[model samples]
Target: MATNPPSIFSDSRRKANRLRTLSLQAGISAPARFVLDDMVDDMAERLAFVRHEPEKVLVIGDYTGRMADEVLPHTASINAADLVGKHAIDLSRPFPVTGFDFVGVLGLLDTVNDLPGALIHLRQALAPGGMVIAMFAGSGSLPALRKAIYAAEPDRPAARMHPLVDTRAAAELLQRAGWKDPVVDSHDLTVRYRSMDRLIADLREQGLGNVLASPAPPLTRVGLDRARQAFMAEADEDGRVTETFSILTLSGRRSLAGT
Candidate 1:
């Protein structure tokens, strides 16, 4: 008998949120795509530095499609998607295809319930000596957002943020998944926002909005005011509050022998 992984996230909600964000980006004149930009830049830098040109590459959760555009000219073939296609793909399960020389994951792994299984599946989809790199928002991210949301419901704070994986745990998971020479790196992105609404809007633009299984109810009018006020408490002289976004990247290669 086979047991299913516990469901920590709502798959339907995740899909809806992703689709909505993509629509929001298409409609906006200049969407906030800092995280997607960061992922694309990271991948480009890595490929250039390694001097390893791959024949086939697979990219998942690339919201901007920049990854495909960036690597298409260099590689023989590239497969990229933001979870939309003829058939829906659930990353928590086994991948539909395998044997890619390189795999790049951006943003999606953070909300998966079975992260360890997902990591293992990523490795399994690779050919021998294939490399995998994944980047996501980690534990030390968004302190300002958390505090403000908490302040809105002083007596009973709802689960406004998803649980984040830290570097130590990510490294350990890679080791457990049997990745060779696994490496985990983290860097912070600081953004100054004049209001909480701007911050939330930006989050949606980047496909980083809420995907929790049982998300908190909409904030009441009074609650929203309190949250905005709390967010402004930490503002600088220019009336902009600085928020930190910690991006953690995990990388490793499969064994050459295809074990």
Candidate 2:
């Protein structure tokens, strides 16, 4: 018997509720909560080049539900899956649906324990010659926030964020996962924040909060205060700290040959 992969995120944790909260908050505050929107927009724009309109599309990790909405116009049908609401499915496990003509993944791959396995499953879920496009927070992101979090516990800094995938590694993973014509691209978004609290709030609102199975204990009040101060230390002349989010996008098609 094949044993399952070691877990990184807590399966029992209320991830569904967390994602639902993110979607609800995003709908109420679109501009203030632009991360989901930005991710969907970027994926939609990149997908615009596909010549063949899909017959059926599966969208994974659509927190705001806009990705499927945008793709709906280009396809006959769309099936959306997130941790909660609509067609809720966890891509970290075997996908319930298969043979989709097109698959779009937004903001979900970074935290998976078996990223390579997830990629392989995604490809397997696709019909021959079907395509997949996935986007997530990649490497070289959140330097200022990382620094602040580290400074908060100079004695022992814990894992405040999940390890992110880089462009090169993503491309290689796609190929290893048996996808053809793999392409990996990345871009950085620099957002300015007035305070650390606001940034933390934004992360929670966007469903980017901690999902680690063995997450570190909550920081003490002193540690939090230090973090806030350290974040502010990175502020520019305008008194706003800059944080960068590196978005990596991967695209590829399943082989036509049923291997």
Candidate 3:
């Protein structure tokens, strides 16, 4: 007998978070979408490096049309959407459309509960010899935040964060999904925060808020203070704590159904 994958993520919460985050980001003059911007730039460079001139493209999770703009020169048509919203896509399920020669996904894969299924569906949505580039925040991100949470609840700690995939696991997943010429690469970016509240707000604005299936209750006042103190304890003389986000890139092509 076969069983479905564990429901590690909550789709309803994820959608709500994305909508609220998008609204919050829209109000800011300079939104915190550095990861999305960086990923689009990297995808463009990779497309040029591979000499791939795709005529039909599908871009997911690029709400600002940045990725679509990058593909405009090479693609005759571009289908763009966020994970959930107007013109949204539910990547966790099978795709309705197919035959795109290029697919670029940004920022949404990490929250998916059935990642392998999603990856396989992505491949299925591509034409033969089609290229796919997907990027997301991976493991080793938010170490400072993680440590602070632990310090705040040393005993009977709650689960407030989503699990992220590591490079090794991502490689294995790509192979399992049968992508041809699959490649997995990662890079880190460092950001400094003045306070834990600001960091949390930034995360929420960037569509990285809590989407865990079983969200923890609000931290008590004492716990929040302890967490804040612990976070600031790691701050530099300038009174800003440094945080790291590791971005993972997965690139591949689908040459055949089996591959």
Candidate 4:
């Protein structure tokens, strides 16, 4: 039997703190608010296509705790969970509640060290024929930032970003985890920024910063100046550079055949 790989994340607690800090900052900024709203809106549209509305719904990474506001109208009950929030639930381990008719996981899978194991847990938590819809920052995101980081250090660039999953790989993992009727798709969202500092702040506020086990040390003053220059060199007519995020969404259902 093939054993699961060891965790690549810094720590569950560290991840939780990062999310908590972001959630607190989200209340004060609109850029931070867009990502969470985007996730919910997309989920809402997809849920509308289902033949029947889910009665018992569980929302993980409920960044703003307002997911219920949108879903509760159709669902009989909705529960929200996050690392540090009103509906607090740690996603690094098994979900605290199970047998839900549907699970909406927003922006949480991006940092999970054991995605296959997490999928298995989600499967076990669902009732027969129940569904799980998850979204995350996918592969090919933050190109400008990556390029600037590389340009900042010509000789030895350190690892700074998480290893994002591609659409094909995500689908394969869903199948490997035994999800029925698995589906995976991706869409791109681009935003223009005047400076790298603004982009970094937005990422931090959106809970999308680095969470690797051994993140690179803080950039030196020379590196920062070089990175900023590199980022600005890519600007357009309006003096703002465009950055793209490939958002990937996956939907899967538990088999109705057996538990």
Which lDDT values do the candidates have, in the order given? 0.87, 0.81, 0.87, 0.82
Off by over 4 Å in 2: 1-4, 14-17, 23-32
Model 1 error, position 90 (Å) = 1.5
Residue 195, model 3, lDDT: 99
Candidate 2 structure quality by residue, lDDT tens digits, 1-259: 9878778777555475365556667566453556667778887777776674678888877655776555556436788777666677777677888988888888778877788998998988898998888888899988999999999999989987777788889988988898888989998878999999988877777667778888899999999999999999999999999999888889999889843
How well is each residue in 47-160 modelled by candidate 3, as lDDT tens digits?
889898888888898867876665556336888878666677888887878898899998899999889999999998899999899999999989999999988989988998
Query: Stretches of candidate 4 above 4 Å error?
Result: 1-4, 12-23, 26-31, 85-87
Candidate 1 lDDT over 69-141, as tens digits, reads 7654554588775666554567877888999999899888998888999899999989999999899999989
- Per-candidate alpha-carbon RMSD to the true structure: 1.6, 2.2, 1.5, 2.0
Worst 10 residues of 4 by lDDT: 12-21
lDDT of 4: 0.82
Full ranking by lDDT: 3, 1, 4, 2
Best prediction by lDDT: 3
Worst 10 residues of 2 by lDDT: 11-20
TM-score of 2: 0.91
